[model samples]
Target: VQPVLEDLDPALEEAAQSLGGSDWTIFTKVILPLLTPALLAGLSLSFARSLGEFGAIIFIAGNQPMSTEITALLIFIRLEEYDYQAAAAIASVLLLAAFTMLAVTNWLQSRALRYTVKG
Candidate 1:
């Protein structure tokens, strides 16, 4: 994210300033618009990572077999019990849901890029 913003041409902001645009205007009109793709990609990846976060959650929420736990943790519990069929079923469902969300986010990101003026 830092690299993406840093790599933008400083000349663009200078040009906007030369045209009487203020800092806010330069950011909203020039910088923010161009950062859309990176922002969306970041959000998409973060969401995907969050969906797979069993380890972190496990520290907070101790394992209780067949009881309340996130899907990822449940899948792990099933595996520990040698229940491959249950784990596989759970994993397949999770994958389908995650894939649907990612697909939608990517589609929206592509659509947004269509209206953006890229360099």
Candidate 2:
């Protein structure tokens, strides 16, 4: 994240410069506003990825029930324990959460795009 932001800083500065006025003004007025979509998208993607993260989390989570266990790990544990219904419930919840987050991000991105186009 730091590296990506650092790389983007120069380009953002250049864009601000092209827009006219001082660097600070350009950064505050133009560059920051323009970065909103990218920032949100990055955040949403990272969150979704984290929610679905199983392998790495399971290794460190200890797989305790209702403790450090993530939804994915819970599902795996349920399956291993032969609790098919519990596994299915956990899977359904995970799917619903993922889909809801994705839908929200899509909606926000669409609204941002519309505003950008109108502006």
Candidate 3:
């Protein structure tokens, strides 16, 4: 994210300001549009990371059966109980969800790129 922000041309903001744009306007019209790809990338990576944060969540939230159950923990519990079919099904669902999220991210990134300034 730092690299992405650094890569953006400072002159773009200066130009916007010279054109009588306010700080908010320069950010929204110039900076924000240029940072779209970085924002989307960060969002996607964080989402994927969050999905796999089973250990942290388990330690912090504790496995409270139905009350505070997470899919990953549920899959592990099913496996421990020798329910291979249930564990496999739950794992499959998680994989599908992750793939779906990636697909949507890619689509949005492509659309955003179309509006980005091409050098």
- Give the TM-scores of the predictions, in the order they appear: 0.71, 0.66, 0.89
The local distance difference test score of model 3 is 0.87
lDDT of each: 0.84, 0.72, 0.87
- List, residue by residue over 11-54, the lDDT tens digit for candidate 2: 55676687786967976665565565777789888987887788
What local lDDT does model 3 show for residue 108? 86
Task: Give the candidate order by descending TM-score.
Answer: 3, 1, 2
Give the best candidate by lDDT: 3
User: Which residue pairs collide, candidate 2?
Assistant: none
The RMSD of every model to the true structure, in order and in angstroms, is: 3.1, 4.5, 1.4
lDDT of 3 by residue, 56-112 (tens): 888889879788888888988999999999999999999999999889889988888
Model 2: what TM-score? 0.66
Stretches of model 2 off by over 4 angstroms after superposition: 1-29, 117-119
Which parts of model 3 have CA positions greater than 4 angstroms off? Answer: none
User: Candidate 1, residues 1-119: lDDT per residue as tens digits?
Assistant: 67778888888889999999999999998888778788888988898888878877778767666565889888877899999999999999999998898888889888767756666
